[model samples]
Target: MNRFRYSSHNLYSLLSQPKSPLHPPTLPSQTLVSLDPSSIDFSNSNQFHTNSSCSSTIPSVSSTGSCPDSALASPFSIKFRSLHLYRGGYIDKGLLVNLYLVKHHCYGTSSSVNQCGFRNVGVNELRYFASHKQVRDILGMIRRKDNDLESKVRSMNVSLNLKMCSRFFEELNNQKRDALAVCDWIRYAHPSCRNDVHSMVIDNLGRLGNYDAMARVLSEFAKKKVRLVPLAFEFVSLSPLKEATVMKVVDVLKAVEEPTRGSGLCSLIKMFSAVGSFDMAELVMQLSERKATFYKIMVVEKCGKGDFEGAADLVEVMRKHGLKPEAKIYNYVLSTLCKHDKSAEAGALFEEMLASECAPDPITYEIFVCHSCKAGNFDLARKLLDRMNAQGIEPRVSMHGVILKGYFNLKRFEEAYEYVMACDRYICFPAICSTLARLYVKADNVIVAHNLLLELIDRGLRPDQSVYTNVFRRLIDTGRTALAEDLRSRLSSIGSKSTMGAG
Candidate 1:
């Protein structure tokens, strides 16, 4: 027996009828909640009722008297269904569609769409109702070795565009084999979009650190005479591939136009320099006109390895090349020197940077301020903040925290309290306030902490949860139940407002 009481055609046809004037349209049941109309796959109608236990018939409207209140409360159950019609039409069309997709497409229940008279419905119809999140989830299933789902999609012969493929690639989470398989699927489904897919796949593989596979794919692209873009090599510079493998990729990329080739080779120079292959870096540097860019990359790598002397040498080399070294290069070396307690060296470099007319940017000032705060030189840190203000550079809220914490660290409670009070609204970030609240509590100044929490509330800022809990607890512990209760109420209000704003 055909267990389903109604055919797909019968169900959709009956729902399309105009609602009779005597019977009003009622909201759908709670089961319709969380249903995404766009994700419903209509490819298989027989799978709709494959669950044998679901063979029971729908009850008529007269039996229930009216739509149940449970259905009325669902926010998503807005679609209306006529109660006086056949039981098949009594439920919202969206509900029926969602049930079909969940069973057949997602859960992999086996049945024949042809048997259900839905053979004419193609994957395109299913895709019309599918969301991007659903597509990503399908790709994610393929990544987790769900061969059945993969086979199902293959049978459907679905085609995705460049944007869709790029999104699906991100959801692969660096699964190299899955990326290739999905790319192959795309190539089969849409041959014209293969070139775009190639760029995405190569870039993804590079990020996955699978350059041997990337090189093979690059060679294929070369054979196809597909034009390469600079973005294709974006992540290759960070990959830890063998020198030979890197060279193999570089050789295959020779077919790329000169402009792209130059940019691509510069990325390789960064890779070589980062891996301590300076000789190879220099050799590759000779192949590109962006020698200054190559110098910057090498300087950063040298600084990362704590070779400040080598980085400075690179700066001198750039000068010799008639390329004025930027503040970025100086800041990189300056940050490293300060981190390593070579403050005197950093100060000299700062002066030299000034002499070289590399007008110190905000980062340049921040570096010195951070270093001074760390070294217990609050006076110099304050002077830097003043200089930043004089130059109209807004001091970063983080710098305020650094200076405030420096005072707290040295047990200068009076100074820390005064500093927090003196700061304007822009400087009083919630994190800084939280840090000060914590420090004050630790110093047995619960009253100040309590007051700071109130002020934060007045400024419409929610304190960190831990700080909120700590202050609220301290209030109760000090026999101030009324204040604690009031604080709890205010925090709850803030949370409610935040939730509403998000909604």
Candidate 2:
């Protein structure tokens, strides 16, 4: 008795029985606009719209519609029609046996009489194996027969057939289950598979949150000249692991030969600083041995995180690597030191950056001025500002705002006002406007504050609620409730929503 059995079921019954009474085809409610043949030029067919709304113009017959006779007229179509006919049980028994032999031999299965007969029996009865489950079982039996017959065949030709059949089952199994697994099999099984398994692995690994595994795979791929650094960076950036682990992975990738280029390293650096891993970030900088631009950014970032020692170490490393420190890096270091009350060192670094060939830009001078003012060294800050002008680097509005803020900190409103006027003449930046408004509110000059707010509005710049809210709170704190209430109402009338409770 044959181990494989096929059940008898018509193709139409197999395709359509699961659904309810089939609805008759109806014309679309939209009128079909007939194009004038003269206007329908096919020459520029490539210009057709490919968007979803236009895709329905392409016609296709329903799968349940009768197969067209015209499709079965050609030789290739006849072969396809023959397969469909075999699927529909229309072939003679002798022809069925011959076709089975041909299919088995072509696909690298055994050509023995027993195998051919088994195939014949299976093919003839395939209609009876109607359900997908039943078809799967029948294919399994065929696979077993192929595997068993492999040992009996003596020729190289038979071995080739066995290999083909094995591959066929592998493909079938892959199709039946996980696409990723199938992709992996194809990617590693044949050099000609052309599927990028690295991408598939990275995608699945990221989705699964397997960072360690992803890191390992990416490292291996990178060694093989596969560019997985971008994905690796994303994995490390989003992984819920400790910032230290993220930094470690970044360092490892950076050390890897010719790391995948573009944005990967930059994003890693940002992620490190975002998570407060300045120390580890410094290590990454040292390991990468990157250009001045990278080190300058790292130093500035470390300073922002208040890691002064880390910033200092980065400077040392820059000098050790024979890279001249730029004005931006020095400014960041100086600002950080000044904020921490290391005014002497801050001033020294500022002077050193200025003396170097990489002359201090306006931003660098601004940092020095702000630091000096913060340290109650107003004379020094004024001298630096004069020197900056002499060097032909005009102060930006931010520089004026910082000096005004410094004056306000020292209770020198007259000096702050003078700097505000100077800022207006040179560059009228939003920061300058906000600072002046804030100062006006401090001095109870509500009219000037309101005018500055209107100026900001006229310039098409939307001031954050905090800007007005801080001023209102300051006014209220100073026992100027009436003015504060009036300003609040005016702000609301202009669509500035406040988060503060009414007094």
Candidate 3:
């Protein structure tokens, strides 16, 4: 089945030249604009109420990914023709079968990524993409070790082939075959693949209780003249750290003429630290002061285990050890806190960044604002926006859109209306303005809504016929015949009614 796609670019064109900012319109003598959405009987399939206004509130707003229920026609809604419904969660028949029949799940298929397919896509993930005959053949080749098919797999994307081959090797019982499969993929499928592949093989061997083969694989990888990736040290730690293995791994690390490249030595320290060889990790760290990121890695590891306090302590330890934490390191910690909704802790981390003189960048502030808005705390979000402006960082449209969305979500329409009015200059996108106007018209604030619609015209964003007709109809119904007639004449002057919404 084809999927829906939406773009931020305007869907309508301007029919007339930009006008001056719209002055407030005169109200009708009689308050006759009925906004009680329930007054209209939505049960009658043939019944179309002019005052029926059911809205998810924001149109042209990006779909939140999750779907929502569409209500009966609301007087405020100006939809041309669109009805969203999940067809019992069914898709194309062939694609549906393809989803379940492959060897490994292809979690990253172009369409399935957006669909509710399994995430992480290991073990059974190949099934998702193996619907392709060539893909299935590649999977078969990897399993059967058909060396002749190497070129075929190589022709595919490097990352993709690597994933399939890696999955193939992981299910192997023989360590030598596993090692051979990885080498086969690298030598044929993607000779230019990074040392991470070799490390992956070594890690796999260790997981399979084949330390001897793991050591052999490491030796073989070392024989290659290419630079070893940081993952080399990681896999070494994965294998047994016996006298021979430890010495072998240490020799590899020490023999490297360039220790800083790819943070090889730092990775060694991290591996040692990760494997409970902290004392060795520290001793190895003494060989290089460029272990700032590794220090953060340890902090991150702490955060992963829910030891946020320990993570913070690790930062202080970093200072004591003469390792300066960069803004990026602090950012990782801050973002993690925000992700976990630890707002109080995130605030502290921000203060700590300022205190440490590790200047926070625009990204740091943006994360804070996004999380704040997502939590529906518009007050904090607004304050953050103000703080960003005070710091000379211009606010982003995404942030305003988020805050406005929060107001609409909370059903705080009055506040949302006032906020929209306050930022009309910045909220210049025709779609968003029209959406807000629709909301206003639904709420019986037709005059305010009409003013906003005119404001769009002045800003050079002329909404189409549906929007114009809807507003005009509401205006006439509310006894504002003068304003309605004037608008009708203005639209007719250019003969633009037919051209409106044409886009």
Which candidate ranks first by TM-score, i.e. highest? 1
lDDT at position 471, candidate 1? 75
Among all windows of 10 consecutive residues in model 1, the one with the lowest summed lDDT is 72-81
In the range 362-407, model 1's lDDT, one tens digit per residue, is 7888887777776677767776777777877876655676777666
Worst 10 residues of 2 by lDDT: 53-62
**lDDT of each prediction vs. the true structure?**
0.58, 0.49, 0.52
* Cα RMSD, each candidate: 23.6, 28.3, 16.9
Error of 2 at 240 (Å): 19
Per model, state how many residue pairs clash.
3, 6, 14
| Model 3 Cα lDDT, one tens digit per residue, 1-503 | 01112223211011011322323333333422324332221112121235323333221111233312321221211111111211222233433233234312332223332243323323321122333565566556656766565566555534334565556555443323555544554544333365556556655554455656654555555556444454545445545554345554554455444422334556666666565565565555555444677777676666666666666776778888777888777777777877887655666667666778887776777777667666665665666656666777655544455555555555555565566556544433454565566555555667766776666565545654465777899999989999888776655555433222211
Candidate 1: where are CA atoms >4 Å away?
1-263, 291-293, 322-324, 425-434, 441-445, 455-470, 473-479, 485-503
lDDT of 3: 0.52
